[model samples]
Target chain A: MPTIWVYAEIDNGKLDPSSLELATKARELGDVEAVVLGPGATEAAARLGEYGAEIVYASDDQVYADYVAQPHVHALTELIGENAPDMILFAMNYDSRDIAGRLSARLGSTLMSNVLEIESVERAKTAIIGGTIIVDVALEGAPKILLARAKSFVAEPLEGGEATVVPVETTVPEEAKRAKRVERHEEAATGPKLEDAPVVLSGGRGLQGPDNFKHLEDLASAIGNTAVGATRAVVDAGWVPYSYQIGQTGKTVKPSVYIAFGVSGATQHIVGMKGAKRIIAINKDEEAPIFQISDLGVVGDALKIIPQLIEEVKSRKG
Target chain B: MNIAVCVKHIPDPNVPPQMDGKYLKREGIQGVLDPGDEFGVEAGLLLKEAHGGEVTLVSMGPAAAQEAIRRGLSMGADKGVLVTDDTLKGADALVTARVLAAAIKKAGQFDLVVAGVESTDGYTGTMPGSLAELLDLPQVTFAKTIEVTDGTVKVNRQTAEGYHVVECSLPALLTVTAGVNEPRYASFKGIMAAKKKPVETWSVADLGLAGEDVAIKQDVAGQTPAEERKAGEVITDDGSAAKRIADFLQEAKVI
Candidate 1:
């Protein structure tokens, strides 16, 4: 019987949510274990056992310390070679994505990136196909690579217990600089995470400059537990980061309720969030593409809509 | 600075339309090089302009996609290559990357490969990462800023929260973010020059990639019309607008 292996992501020593979700999903596959890469290898392995990993493979070598594409890819490839697990699951994070490709090639197995939804996995040979997912993929031969969209799957804490910890040192050549720590910035309030949030509030070029998003931020805060997203146009306008974009180019978030204010809803933008449960659009253009998919469309200026929407939320909650 | 930018032609999403049965009713809808791919081409141009090298545009789709190649040429690419074969339709990112990889290895002139984060339709956002894997090259996807000099390169990758800048070596792969560069329109002179540019077409046989190697495992299944939405009654009065706003939130389950 083949066991499921999860390539866990960790910062400092805490496990990333994606790795947790992967372990939870892997539960269905059979015995689920984790492969953690970080400084606190032993402690991280124990944490992984609590989360769901029956086994923890950790490292603290120079190559694995700082985040660099080459070293990480090399480490994952070597791990796969030794274990030869049937399936490998990675959270669709930057590092996971960059490494999976290398591992897939080195193993000659199939690689499916950014899988939004996973339907089933009974017989190892059952075929999987399309359903709001990027594509239906089946890993035919040996070890398989699956990069699950982290946000689509919900995360829950697992039973706490220290697991068997296995330590290893990753090797790097003399020429490598060992990717140095440069700069890191965090969003003011990402809210509950756009994917997990019940409500997603996104803005577009109608919101104007990058600073104008202050109103959006307030609106998101007023909505209390909602996440903030952005249209491709706004992201392209440099008003927001591409990660915040709610279009084809950004995160394809499907919240319970998606609200678009001052968004023109380009097709590319709509593709990202069209899966939301309920969509509401507020734009001056009655003919905007956002209106095409919005369940409730309000044609008006977004600047005005934001203030009014924010006030109404406060009033109702009061 | 020698760069390779992969381009794909997509249906104009701005136009209201869907696949009616098998063929596109394109009755009124227009088509254009995908906006994301335009960014890829533009990013390649910027790299070439800065590092003083050539930008090559590679298109793998139907012959109609030649327009995408011409557009890339118009964008200042030194050359163009179109890999056309009907069987290449609906190619999953994995197979598409393999096909491209074979062609890339054959050409053997690229130092950097750039592609849109995702196509307007497939929308997987995995090509750059996948291609880099096939070629065993280091990759930086969703790049906000990429500066290369000599053999060293620095890139800013966008994450959910803020931004992180990374420095790496050359011969890397990058899937650019949309805001990284504004795509310039093709000039009239460029368009004229594009007509004379050479675009190499490679088939599955020529590329040494079998249909099974590159064809999508699944068919589109089908495309349903986007649910129709109405612009509802206008708020005739200011007070009425406020009322609708309140009722809207209640109905939308926001409150």
Candidate 2:
């Protein structure tokens, strides 16, 4: 079987769910193994094993105990040299992209980023030119690096299967330790994460003002498990934080249910959330292009419609 | 306190391109500097203002890429370098990174190398990290705010979770995201001054690279226009849009 190695990022003793999804997808391609890095790699192995990893290379080294790119790149470079895996999959994240890109340069190999689908060991597909075209690319090299887009695969557990965990033994060079993480300013997030939330409620310029976003917050709270998002127009207008922006320049989200309120759905906005399983757009303009891609298009004033929708949803929940 | 900013020339993002069968047709499309790279230019200029150093713009593309260098010059960059050769026609991300690393090294010592998180056209988002590794420099990717002090650089990096403050010694690399700073428009005076600014053109040979060293590693097997989503169910407002939406949500089983 072709050996596939997945780079799993661990934080606070937990394996990122997106990495598990990558591991789950790797099973179909070949015999899958996971290489977890950082302080909690050892603790994360068991969880990764449950997601169909055949082997887990857990590195609980102090050199990588913090968030830095060079050390991880050095560790992965050594692992690729030792294992000679045919392909390595990295979950699309900051650290994974950093390490994968660096390792590809070190090894003179091909690194494919934002891959949407994998056709085979040799060929993969990614969106290019601002999501206007899909290109099937064949990478010619050993240890092909694929950075799978986040949420491209579902994390399916393989019950009753356990992976053999092996501690990774590698030394981080002195030069690799130059960069240090000083502090992390974590956002005071209380609700579901935009990417993790199954239901997303996003507002646009039609919401009128920043204060009007409170209605979206009410609807989201009423829905219980929804994350609030915003369009570029609203974000540019200073109605929302950059973190709340969803578009070509913002967060790319693929929720199970996406509700767009007052969003005219520019191509920039649509490219970010088009992967929603069910897209529901609420727009006052019936001629809006958002209705073209929406699974359910509701033509009405959001101000008049959202309050009633919230009441209806609350009553249903009651 | 010398900095190098990597910029790219791409087809204008505003105009939807006419496809050349399986690839983007570039013959008639106006090529502008990649929008994302403007942030890099702006950051580099800001760094220069703070640290009192020169910002050298670098790019790897066809001869037309000089347009991007001129634009950067017009935006207050000091000098520019263009690396172009026929062999680099289909270069992939890794190859591009290697060539850029070489060009940066050839341009001499730089305290920092700044680039866009990804090019608007390719969107690989990996070249800066690759370039850093090739040059053996510390990298801070997706930085929102960058500060250079006492031979070190600090940045606030954007992440899926939130943000992190990262610090690295000088002679490092940083890839910036959009919204990091407001890019300045090229002024008439600046545009005129750009004509006098020196832009050096180099080939693969100048960087001690050959056709094989920078050959593209990925082959395009085929291409397809992006899949268009169809309007599945469109209903006008009959004073029951909310109820209809609720029922549709229930039927879709997403509630």
Candidate 3:
């Protein structure tokens, strides 16, 4: 079997769910190994093993957290040079993309991003043109670098023992420590996260104005497990925070149900939510492209329909 | 402060894309400067206006890519350098970065490099990071705000939760988000002045790269249509539209 290494990420003393998802998928492909860095590497390594990572290369270095991506890149480059795995899978996020890009440049290897599925170690599948077409791509070089999109695979833990934790040692050059992250400002958020929510209610310019988002919030509250989302246009208009934006550049959500209000369904926005199990779009324009993929499309003013829908839902529950 | 801005000329996003076998058909489609890169151009121009230096646009695409460069020039940039060659037809992100690094080196010594968070067409969002690595420069991606003083660059880097205050020294690279600043339209006078700005076009050979050096590392085995989500029911909203939707939701067991 080919060897596959998963670049694992840690969040709040736990392994990031996306990393675990990649590790779970990697187990099906080959012998699963992992490389995790930062403050919680030791703890995360144990969890990674439960998700099918047999051997974990870990470094609990504070420098990985203090600086940007270079330290991790330096350490990973050295590790890959020492033990060349057939393929390395990365989660599509800020630090992963940063390290993957640098590693691909340093190794002179091809890197594929936004991968949706791994057909095999030699081939992968990706969506292009706003998720309208799926392309099967051949992985040409050894040590294939693939950045898998979030929510592509389900993470399942196996009944496994502790992995062999190997410490990663590399001298981080002074040049690599140039970019320093001084402070982090986490936006105050409540309710469920947009990505993890089962149902999502999204808005766009057709919502009329920013103040109308309160209606969406009210509906989400009534829906119980629903989260609010917005299109790039609405986010760019400052109607919502960047965290609430769902599209190509924003978060990709595969909720069980996605209900869009006034979203004209730009290709960028469609790509993010196309994987949703059911899509319901409401727009005034009958010709909006969103209707093409929507399971149920409504043509009318969102402003008039929202209040009535909210009432209807509340009355039925009562 | 001398600034270099990496830009891209892509097929207009407003137009539906057409596929030619494994590749996108580019010859017939209209091309425009990537909208995302406008923020980068605007950021560079704003810095040059304050710091009193030049803003140079660097790009790699077909000969038609000059239009993108000219658009940047018309926005008050100084000049442009475009690397266009047949060898770079299907160049991946790494190859593109290598070529841009070479062309940037040829352009001159720059204290800062700027680009968008991602391109509209490919949207890989990896070029700037790869280029920064190849050039041995510190990189700050997803910058919402940038400030420069005394050879240090400070940025508000956007993240999933919020933003991070990041600092790096000179000779660095940054990818600016759309929220960074408002991009200005080209004034008539600026458009006329752009015609006089010198633009240098170079080939891959001029950048000291052979065909093998930039060989495509991946191939498209085949392309198939994504599983279509069939349209189920459509209705124009009347007074009872909400009732109908609520019933549908109950049937779907989502409510």
Candidate 4:
């Protein structure tokens, strides 16, 4: 079997679940190995092994976290040079994209992003045209670098023995330390994350104004485990934070049910939420593009219907 | 200070994409400057206004892509450098970066490079990083706010949780996210002035690269329509829409 390497990430002593998900999926294509770096790499290696990583290359160096992606790129370039794997899987994220892009440039190889599935070592599936078309892309080169969208695969830990732990040692060149991260600010958010929520309630420009988002919050409260999302229009209008934006640039969600209030279904917004198992959109325009893919389409003013929907949901639950 | 901003001309996002066999059909669709790149243009203009430097717009695409650069020039960029050739038709991100890096070098000496975090059409979000790597420059991505001082650049980099305050020296690259700045529409005067702006067109050979050097690495083996979500019942509100939706939610077992 071919050997596949997963670039795992660790933050604040916690391993990103997407790494485990990729590791699990990689087992089917080839032997699975993982390279983890950051503060908790040593601690996260065992969990990676449980998720089908036969070998775990780990380093607990602060350099990976202290600087931007260059240090990690330095380490990964060395690791890949020493032990060339047939393919490398990266979970699409801010840092992963940075590292993968740089690594691809350094290696003079091509990197494919927004991959949704791996059919085999040679072929992968990606969505284009705002998730309306699914295409199988041929992985052309050895050590193919693939950045998979998060939540693309189920992360299931296997009952297996401990993996052989390998140490990754490399000195970060001074040039790689040019960009320094001085401070981190975490925006405090309550409720389930949009990606993990079972139900999602989204607002769009048709909601009329920013203050109207309260109706969405109320409705989300009535429906347990629901997170609020916003279209790119409203988010760009400063009606909501970037975290609440759902689209090509923002987070991709595959909730069990996605309820959009006043969303006109721009192609950008649809790509982020089309993966939801059930979609219900409410808009005054019967011709709204959102209705094209919605499981239940409601033609009406969202401002008029949201309060009633919130009340109906609350009363039914009671 | 000299600044270079990478911009892209793409199929208008408002128009639904059409497929020609396994590839996207770009023959007869309306094209526009990628919406995301507008923020980069605005950022470069702001930097130029603050630091007293010329902003050079750089792009790679077919001849029609000049429209994208024209839009940028109309936004206050001083000049434009476009690398357009038939071989660059399906160039991947790395190849595009190599071409852009060569073009940027040929354009002039630049202390800073600005770009959108990703193109709206491709949405790969890797161009700036790859370009920075090939150019051997310090890099920052997802910048919501940028400040330049003597020989140093500071940025408020957006992250999943919040933001990071990052610092890099001059001769660096940074990618700006949407909402970083309000992009101004081209005034009539600016639109007319853009006609006089110098836009140099370069081929792959002009940049000292061969067609084989930029060959695409990924291929679309096959394409199939995504499984369509069947349209369900539609109900117009006459004061009962909410109740029907609640019932539908109950039936779906998701509430």
Candidate 5:
């Protein structure tokens, strides 16, 4: 069987959900092994095993404590050289992107980012030009790197055997440690993370202003496991933080259900969420491009329909 | 502190890019500076103002890429450098990073290099890290706020849960996210002043590199338009749109 190596990330002594999601996809391609870095990563191996990681290769050293991407690059590159995995997968995050790029340079290999699907064991697909075009990419080398978009694959836990933990030893280059961590300011997440949210309610310039975003928030609250997002229009207008922007230039999300409110389905915005399993678009303009891809299109003013939808959802639960 | 900001010239995303057969058609599309690079340029300028140094703009593209560098120069950068080569077309991110690293090395000593989190066109968000690794410098990315002092750089890097305060020494590389600051519009006087600024143009040979050194390794076997979703049921309500949506949600087993 083809062996796939997943770059697992550890957060607060637990395996990151996105990393586990990568494992979930990696196992489908072949024998799934996880390469985890930093302190406390070994502790998360059991959880990684539950999510389809057959073997956990871990590196926990002082040089990795600072969260620099280079150290992991040094460690993982050595591991990949020792055991030549057919494919390597990573979550599409800051550290993973950095590491993949550097590793690709080191190995003289190809790194494909924002990947949506595994077309086969060798080929994958990604959206280009803000989702207006989808391109199938083929990597020509062993140990090809694939950075999957956030939430592209669901993290499913299976009842299976524990992963055999293997410790890998490597030296961190002095230059990699040049970057240090002084402080960590945690922005208390108000609700479910957008990537993990099962349902996403997004707004755009069609909402008129920032204040209208509250309607989507209320609707999100009504539907548990929901998060709020905005199009680049609202983000550029300074109405919402860039963290909440979902578009070609923003975060690519693949929630189970995506509800676009007052969003005009610009290809820029569509590229981000078009991977959603079910898309529901609400807009007054009947010809909005968003409706073209939506599973359910509602032609009406969102300001009027949102409140009613929230009430209906709440009443149904009651 | 001497700073280098990497910028990209891309076809205006506001205008839909056309496709000639399977490739992106760039002949008629207007090229502009990638929007994300504005924040990088702004951050470099701010660092220069506070620390008292020069901010040099570096870019790799065809002749028209000079337009992007000039825009940065107009935004208060001291000078600009453009790396243009006929053989550099279709170069991937790793190759591009190598070229940029070579250019930065030739530009002389720099305390810091800044870049946008990702280019709107390529959207890989990997160049800065690749460049950092190639240059053997510390790299920090997704900075929401950046402060430089005492030969050190500290940034509040954004995260899924919140943010982290990452610190690195001078001679580091940082990739800033949007919302870090509001980039200023170039004043008329600044625009006129930019015309006289010296912009050094270089070829691949000047960087002491052959075409194969920065050649793209991946092959695009083929590109087809993404599959379109089928026409779905549209409900235009006079007054019952909400009820229909509620029912539809229930029928779809989503509510």
Candidate 6:
């Protein structure tokens, strides 16, 4: 069987959930190893064993002591060369993506991101295309790289397995110290919680300005529990956070119900929300690309249409 | 200073997202620069152009993602690298970051690495912070503006509540939000320049990563499409349009 590797993340001795999911997916393809880095990774290594990692690769060197890319690169790259696993699994985190990208580029295999399921083990060589998720690509290669979204894979519990925690020490390049950690201030997320929200209500440049979102919000409020999003134009205009923008550059989501207000439907915007099941769009421009894919279309001014739709829904329910 | 920017090629979402069962069917779609990441790429290019340094666009997701890097190069990056390994297919956020970290280190030197705060397809939005943790790189997430002078970086960041300023040294990791700079479109000349740039390809082993290193840490619990949105019947023309509209809302319990 192929050896599948997952980048098991350890922070203060706890394993991150995304890594666990990658471990689970890796198990499907072949034997699994959970790779951990940093001083606290020992605790994380043991936890990974409990979760089902057949082997734990731990790197705790001065360079890796604090989570620098150079050492992790040194350790993991060396590890991949030594083990020759058939598959590599990683979460779609920032560093994970870069590492995967770098590795894939070096290895000459395709890296697929935001994957939802495993169609078949035979097709592990293939890359997944688009957000709707339909293909299992089997590339002709010894080892391939795979990236899964955090919540997209369902990790099953393993009966009983002890992961082999192996401590790894690698040399830290002089440049490793160039990047250091500073303080991070997290803001309370308000506008739209994309990952957790079931429905999303988005506004585009067609809305004209931020104040117009008041009406779009009225519709969202009527829907209740839906998060709000924006197009790049609005996000660039300072109407919303870059986090809320949806398109080629923004967040790609698969919501159950997505309502596009005043969006003239750019192709970039469409890629982000196309996975949504039910697409409802209201735009004065019926020819907007968004209308082409929308399950339901209302040709009218979004500002006018949204409030009226909100009122109509309220009146109907009452 | 040397900088690296990670970019991905994504299908245009404005078109019908072709699907086969649970898979997103990627065919016949134009791959373009992930608009979200364009901000990050633009940030890197502008910094390099102003600061007199090299900007390497690293695309490790898939061979297809190289297109995105070419787009970045056209925007004025110095070089390009594409890491293509099948093992990276469907990798979760953690492995994705690890692979990137591996590539960045092996690529030799970089004072900074920038990426879009989040990818357009994954929408996890956790990678930036997670990357900071993994890379141990001082980071500024959701940066709106970044001004670097004499190796000291000053940034205007977008918090969920409002914007804030952050200062840091060089050789850090940063996740950029939109408005870090208005991403400039590629002119014909710029496009030609990208073709003249160099693109290096690497593999998992080439970057010094063992094949069976990182394992899955979490499962994708479940994915339910956005909740169904019911469309209220349209009542147009006639004197009854307003009444019908009102009646629909009353029945739907909106008002």
> Which candidate achieves the best lDDT against the true structure?
3
Cα deviation of A163, candidate 2, in Å? 1.5
Error of 2 at A119 (Å): 2.5
Docking class for model 5 is medium
lDDT of 3 by residue, B155-221 (tens): 9887776778999999899889887888999999999999999999999999988865688898888
Q: For model 5 chain A, give the 10-residue run with minimal summed lDDT.
A: A180-189
Each candidate's DockQ:
0.36, 0.59, 0.73, 0.73, 0.52, 0.11
**Real contacts recovered, all predictions:** 0.31, 0.75, 0.72, 0.76, 0.63, 0.06
RMSD (CA, Å), candidate 4 to true, equals 1.5
User: Can you write out model 1's per-residue Cα lDDT over B1-255, one digit (the tens) per residue?
Assistant: 688888887667566445544334323346678888888999988877777888888877777777778888987887877787777655656777777887777655788888877776555555666687787666766778888876866777776666677766678777887778888888999888888888888887898877457645433433333234443444323434545766766877678
Question: TM-score of B chain for each model?
Answer: 0.87, 0.91, 0.96, 0.95, 0.94, 0.86
**CA lDDT of every candidate:** 0.69, 0.84, 0.88, 0.87, 0.82, 0.66
Residue A145 in candidate 2, Cα distance off native in Å: 0.4
Query: Candidate 6's interface RMSD, please?
Result: 8.5
Cα error, residue B121 of model 2, in Å, equals 2.1
Looking at model 3, give its docking quality level. medium
Give the alpha carbon lDDT tens digit for every residue of A185-245 in model 5: 5545479888668788899878998898888888888878788999876876778766787
> What lDDT is obtained when candidate 6 is compared to the true structure?
0.66
After TM-score superposition, the amount by which residue B115's alpha carbon in candidate 5 deviates from its true location, in angstroms, is 0.9
User: Which ranges in model 1 have alpha carbons more than 4 Å from their true place?
Assistant: A12-14, A121-139, A157-162, A173-181, A187-199, A221-227, A241-243, A247-257, A266-278, A287-295, A314-318, B16-30, B208-239, B248-255
Clashing pairs in 4: none
Better of 4 and 5 by lDDT: 4
The full ranking of all candidates by lDDT, starting with the best, is: 3, 4, 2, 5, 1, 6
All candidates: TM-score = 0.85, 0.91, 0.97, 0.97, 0.90, 0.61
Segments in model 6 whose C-alpha atoms lie over 4 Å from true places:
A8-21, A36-52, A56-68, A105-110, A113-136, A150-152, A155-174, A247-252, A264-268, A316-318, B1-144, B152-178, B183-255
- Worst 10 contiguous positions by lDDT, candidate 2 chain A: A233-242
Please write out the lDDT profile of model 6 over residues A59-164, one tens digit for every residue.
6543453433445655677788888877677765544654564455444444555555554433532122332233344444556566665555556768786788
Could you give the CAPRI-style class of model 6?
Answer: incorrect
User: What lDDT score goes with residue A100 in model 1?
Assistant: 72
RMSD of 1: 4.3
